[model samples]
Target: MNSASDLGALAHPAATPAALPTFDDVLAAAARIAPHAHSTPVLRSRTLDALAGCELHFKAEHLQRAGAFKFRGACNAVWSLPDATAARGVVTHSSGNHGAALALAARTRGIPCHVVVPHNAVAAKMAAIRAYGATLHHCEPTIAAREAACAAVQAQTGAELVHPYTDARVIAGQGTAALELLGHDGRFDALVTPLGGGGLLSGTAITAAAVSPATRVFGAEPAGAADGFASLQRGERVLELAPDTVCDGLRGLLGAPNFALLRAHRVEVLLADDAATVQALRLFWQRAKQLIEPSSAIALAVVLANRERFAGQRVGIVLSGGNVDLDALAGLFASA
Candidate 1:
C-alpha cells in the first residue's frame, strides 16, 4: 500500500484540497479533547483472533463516553467553538449516536443543543439524546427532512451547525481514536472501522496515512446500506438512498468531504450482510464479552467473510458503539 506521503500515486491531484484536515489537525484535536474524550483501550481477543485467523486488536470505543466513538468528534466540535459562538449553542441532525454524542458534548460545555432526529430513530438512542438535555426535533425519516429541520433550528436559535461527519473539526476529532489506537498498540497491517457517513473511516485513513504509513485502511459497510461502496465504485458521491439495514447508524449517505478523503487515501470498503453482521455481533458478545451494536460488528463480519485477505495479519478493528435497543434485541438476533 502507498503511504499517505505518496498521495500523488493514489489521489487525483485536484480532488484533495488544502482545506481538508491533515495530521496536524488530528494532533490539535487530540490535545483539545484530551480532558473530555477517553483514550479508549486497544483490546486483544485471542479467541477472536483464532476464529478470524488474524491477530485482532479491537479499539474499544464502545466503552467511550456516551457509549460510542461519536463522542470524540462531537466533543471536539462542541469545544472548538469560541466562547461567543458556543454561547449561541450547537445543532445537528442524527439518527441516534451522533445526536446523543453532540447532546452530551454540549452539556459538557454548558451550552444548549438541538438535535433533529428522524421519527424512525431507535427509542433507546432518542432517550439518550433527551437525557443529555438537548431539545429534540422530529422529522420524517429522510435526509431532506432532517436537513430542513436542522436548518429551521439553526435559523431559530442561531446555533452553530456541527455536521455529524462532514465538518473538518469533527473529522479531525474522529481521527484521534486511531491516533490513540496506533500510538498504544503500534503498527498494524490493516485497520477497519464501521462506515456510516464516513467520519470514522476518513479519520482512520488519515491517521493511518500519517502515522502508520504502510497500514491499509478499510471501511466495513452493510450490504443493505452499501452507499459507501457504491460511491467509491462510481467515483462520485451518491446523494440519495433509501437504506434498508438493521444497522441504523450505518444508514446515512456518505458526506462529500468524507468521500473525497476516502478516495484520496485509497481507502477500500468491504460489505457484510445483515445475517453475517448479527452473527458477528453474537460472537463478539459470547467471546469478547463486548456488547457492540451491529454497525460496529460489521467490521468483524467483513474480516470473517474475507478470511484469506486478513489471515495472519495484524488487523485493528474499531468497535464503534454499544448502544443496542434492548427491546429489539430478540427480533434482531432471531433474524440471524
Candidate 2:
C-alpha cells in the first residue's frame, strides 16, 4: 500500500448547522456515490421467509463496495471534503470494514488515507484495508486506544478525521441504502439492520422517519456486546464493554450522535446471542446462496429469535457486510 506521511495542512471550510444533512442529504449521497458505489440488489428467500413468517426484502450490502454498507458513509466523508483539504488527506479508526471502505474511497480521490485499526480486527479486513493503499497503525482493541491512535495520526498527518460512525456526514451517507430500499415498490412494515457503532442503524432510522414514518426501524445487536440495546433501554448512551461475541464489527460502544438520533426516531433495539448469529449465517448461506459476516447475520438472528415482531409483514433488512476471514470460518461454524 502507498503511504503519504506529509501532504501538508490545508484550509477546510467550516460547515454550519443549516448545512447539516437531512433526508435530502441522503438522496444527494446516493447520486454522489452512484458512480463509485454499487446500487446493490434486494434479495429474497422463500424458505427463510416461511421460517421467520415475514416477507423479507434483503438489501444486499454484502455486495456493496468494500463488501459492506460502510462504503456509503466513507464515500461521503471523502467526497465532502474541500478540494484543498481533500488534497491533504483523510484519517479514521476502525475495527475493519469502515477502515477498508475509507481507504477505497480515498483511493478514488487520489488522496492519502490513514487507518488506525484495532489489533484484534479480522485479518482479511486488515489485509483489505492495506491492499487499498492506506497506511495502517495498529492499536489496542479498546475504544480509547483506537481514538488515541487515530488522534495522533490526524495531528501528525493533518488528515481530517472521519469517525467510523459518530460523524454526521457518515450517518447521512449510510442512510442512502434505506432511501433506495424504502423508495422501491411495496410498503414495508419494518426495517432491521445490525447495530454496531450505529452508523447504518442511525442512518436507517433517520431515513425511515422521513420517508416511511409508519415503518418501524429496528436495531439488532449481539447479546455479548449489548451496550447499544442497554443504552436504548436506559434512554441514554452507555460506556463501552470488552465485547465477547463473534460479531467483531459490532463490538464498539454506541456513538453519542448515534444514540441521540436513534432515540429521536424511537428506534427499537433487539439482542441476539453468538450462537443465534451463527445459525443465521448458515441459514442465509444455505437458503439465500449468499455469504454474510456474523455482524450482518445478527439482524436476521434477531428476526428469527422474535418471529412475532415481524410476522406476516413486509420487512427490509440491510445485510451490512461480508468480509469474514476465511481461515476462521470452520471454527466459527463448528463452535456454534
Candidate 3:
C-alpha cells in the first residue's frame, strides 16, 4: 500500500482539533439518539471465555436498529441537523451497513435520503437500503467512484453530506456504543472493535479515554484490509490498496478525521486473517448462539490470537453488525 505523508491530501481532509468529536459530543449523541437507537444488550459466553482465557463482554450491536451500530451515528447525524438542512435531505456513500443505516435514519425524520453504493456491494445490504426508502445510485467499487457519485447526488438533490465515518457527528454517534457498554458495567481492562473506516474504533477510543481512563483501546482489523494498522505503525495514512477479504463491511479506507482521533487516543490495532475470522464467526454462532458477521467476529479472533494480552482480564468486544447475506452462510462456513 502507498503511504500519504500528508493525511490532509487524502480524500477526506484532516479535521481541525476543535472539530474533532469529544466525550461531550458523545454524551450529547447518546441523548439525541436515545429514542431512535436501541441500547443493545451485552452478552456473555462462559465456554468461549474459557477458550480465550479472558472474560468476554459482547456488545450486541447486531440487534441495533437497521441491524448495526452504524445506526447510532446515522441517527445522530440525521437528528442533529437543523430543520432547514434536514429538509434538504442527507446523502452518503457506504458499501452496505452505513447505507442501510442512513436510509433508516432519514426515514425516521421523513426526509429524502440518497445512498451511493458500489456495484459489488452485498445483495442483502443493497436490498436493505432500498427497503428503507432511499434512492440507490450504483458506482464502481472504488473510493473515487463512490465519492464522485455521492458528490453528483448531493449537487442534484441539495442534500447535506453525512459521511459514513469521517463526519464529527457520526463519530460522536458511534461512540455511544462504547459509552453504553462501559456504563452497563464497571471498568473493563480493554475494549476492542472492528476497524474499517475507523468510525467505530475512533469513537470507542474516545469513550474509553473519557469514561475509563485506565482501559486500553484496541482495533481488530482484517489482515487483508489492514490499512488502519499500517497507518498507525507508519504515523501516516496508507491510502492505496485493494482489500482482499471476506469481511465486506471493512473494505473502506480509513478516513482522515477517524485516523486523527485514533492516533490522538493512542489506539492499538491487531490483525486477523480471513480463515481465523471465519472460524471465529462459526465459534460465535455455535457457542454463543448468536449470529455475527465476519467483520464483527474479527474482534474475537484478535483476542483469541493474542491470548497473553487479554488473559484473565475483562474485555469488551463490540459486535459491530449482523447484516450478513443469509444465502452465503453455507459457503462462508464451508471454507472455515
Candidate 4:
C-alpha cells in the first residue's frame, strides 16, 4: 500500500480561498496556455445521448496532448515559472498523465523536466514521459513514499515543483477544459467528470459557475477508492487511499485546496465500483465507439444510472484520458 507521504501533497496556507480560479483566473490561464495546447474535439453520440436521456457533449480530452487533458495544466505551470526558476527546470510526481504532460510541455519551452513516478506506473505513460525529455525518478508505490521522494528530489535538484492537481496555477489551467466546453457550446445544464485529486473537478466547478451558474458540477469516483465522495460527505478533507482499482489514475485523494474548492462549489460526488466502470466502458466501446479509461467511464456510468437527474437536459462531460493498456482490456470484457 502506498502511504499518504509517498504522494506529494500541495502546501496550502491557512488563508487560501476555497472558492478559487475565479473566471478571471481561468481566462488568464486559457490565454497563457492557448498557444501551446489543442482545442480537443467534442464528440457526440446520438445513441448514447438517447440512452442517457441527455444531450451528451463529450469533450474528448483524451485526444489532447500526451493523451490526456493534463497538458493544459502542465503547460500553464511551466510557462508561469520565471526564467531563473525555469532554468533549474520543473519537477512533479505523477502516476502517468501529468508526468507526460509536464514532460511534453517542458520540452516545448526548452526546459528540463523531472518526474517522480511509481515503479508500478503504466509502461507506456512512463515511456511517453521519457520520450518527451523528462528525467525519471522511480519511487515507492505509497502516496507517502512518493511525497518523501519528491521532497528529496526538489531539494537535491532545485527544480521548481508542479504538483499534479493541487496548485492554484494548475487548477486554473485545468479550468480551461470547462472554458473550452462552455465556449464551444454554453448550453450544458450540468458538467460531470471523474475526480481523483480534484484537478478536473475543481476546474469544472470554476468553469460551470462562471459560464452557467445554474449548471451543477458533479464528479464520479470508484467505490473502492471513493475518498472524494467520503470526504465530501464528511465535510472534511480525506487524504488517505490505497491504490486498488482498475481506475489506477483515480487512486489518489483530493488535495487540500481542491477539497476546499469542491466544498465552496458544493459539488456532488457519486460512487461507482470497478464492475460498473467496466460495464460502462464496454457500453461506450460498443455504442459510442469510443475508447476510454475506467476513470472516464465512471462519469459515463453516473449519467447512465442517474437518468432522471440529467433527463431532458444537455450535459457536458470531459473524457479525461485514454492511455489504457490494450492487453489488460481483454480481461475487462472477458466476463461480460
Using TM-score as the measure, the top candidate is 3
Query: Against the true structure, what is every candidate's RMSD?
Result: 6.7, 5.6, 3.8, 2.9
lDDT of 2 by residue, 270-308 (tens): 999899999999999888888899999999999999998
Q: Residue-wise lDDT of candidate 3 within 1-336, one digit each (tens)? A: 111211111245334433889999999999999989999999999899999999999999999998899999999999999999999999987646887899999999999999887776667667889999999888876657767887898889899988778889999999999999999978999999999889999999999999999999999998988899999999988977557677877777788888898999999999999999998998999998887888899999999999999989999999999977788777777766
Candidate 1 local distance difference test against the native = 0.85
Per-model CA lDDT versus the true structure: 0.85, 0.83, 0.87, 0.82
* TM match of model 1 to true structure: 0.92
Q: List candidate 1 stretches off by more than 4 Å.
A: 1-18, 140-144
Give the range of the ten consecutive residues with the poorest summed lDDT in model 2.
2-11
Candidate 4, 1-336: lDDT as tens digits: 223322443322223434456778888899999889999989998989878888999999888888888898999889899999998899988756788899999998999998888787667767878899899998877657777888888898899988788778888999999999989987778899998888889988988887888988999888878888988899987655555567767877787788888999999998877787888888888987777877788899888988999999999989998877786767666633
Clashing pairs in 2: none
Evaluate model 3: give its TM-score. Answer: 0.93
For candidate 2, what is the TM-score?
Answer: 0.90
Candidate 4 weakest ten by summed lDDT: 5-14
**TM-score of each candidate structure, all chains considered together:** 0.92, 0.90, 0.93, 0.91
Where in model 4 is the C-alpha error above 4 Å? 1-20, 142-145, 240-243, 334-336
- Ranking of all candidate structures by their lDDT, best first: 3, 1, 2, 4
136-199 per-residue lDDT for model 1 (tens digits): 8988765566667878988988999887788889899999999998999998999999997888
